[model samples]
Target: MQSVDVAYAEEWKMDHGIMVPLHFLTPRYDMDIIPVNINCQGPPLTPLNRVWEFGKALRRACDSVPEKIAVIGTGGISHWPATPNSVKIVEEWDRDYLDKWLANDKEALLAYTDEDTLKDAGQGGFEIRTLTAISGLCEGKKGDLWFYEPIPIFSVGCTVGVMEV
Candidate 1:
């Protein structure tokens, strides 16, 4: 095992066109917890500027690749009501969140953060970051959310979206 600093440094070099370390937890490694600029806390973490940079990178990468890209977004449609009325509860707030997401509004992107909301929404909630990543590539385009399914047995929310350029 390597220290976090050593591992992180190796990972940092990958951003500058170097071969990523074998153990780095990137998409290639079947891990998806990517570090956002906000979490970097470094000199390069200017919010809007960084977002633009990410947008450019995503666009370039997607254009460079010839494979069809599937943009999936997960989470939401959860309400922790004090009284359990029924097994299924519809959440208008969550629908509004999805609306803003499909609209590709960056401001709306940053507002949907609550650990409780994520937990209550379940596994698919982890997919929100996927939406955020796709948003960078689809900044000014119209997106369609084609699927929204809640699996109460697993306490998970799943959604699939497509971005039109």
Candidate 2:
């Protein structure tokens, strides 16, 4: 709820900030949404800058939390969004991510670099970074894809998947 003098984005997102809010907005909460950040009473924590570090941290999260919390990973399979030219789909990178994710191959899945992700998927592929973070949160869980669609008009690949606790 950080804001300035005037109004601000009701939902300002960075990294994976939107996930917690989105999780509550779903029907599981009986349509009630809580837009607040929970403080764990520790030093200000920043998400790991690199994927490898992020991968290692998930195990700690799984061990620490004593309750069941569902995590949804939303993003894309592969696409170059906002391109005026023809669409480019990086099926290879997308499939690799999916495979590693399904197999719970933390090391391989977290080793992805921005360069590789963008080059193969495009700038819009940046959204997948959120999915990676979500993946870390879902280590021991299984995921089910709700939907995946490639929009040629928007040059975007949109997908939504859920991992349960």
| Residue-by-residue lDDT tens digits, candidate 1, 50-140 | 4434554656755777876433322234533222532443445456657877888877775555454445543233334545656766778
- Misplaced by over 4 Å in model 2 are 1-30, 34-69
lDDT of 2 by residue, 51-83 (tens): 324433544554677865444344555666546
lDDT of 1 at 33: 37
Please give the range of 10 consecutive residues that has the lowest summed lDDT in model 2.
38-47
Highest TM-score among the candidates is held by which one? 2
Error of 1 at 1 (Å): 26
How much is 11 displaced in model 1, in angstroms? 14
Q: Tell me the whole-model lDDT of each prediction, alpha carbons only.
A: 0.48, 0.52
Show where candidate 1 strays beyond 4 Å. Answer: 1-56, 65-90, 113-127
Candidate 2 yields a Cα-based lDDT of 0.52
RMSD from true fold, candidate 2 = 8.4
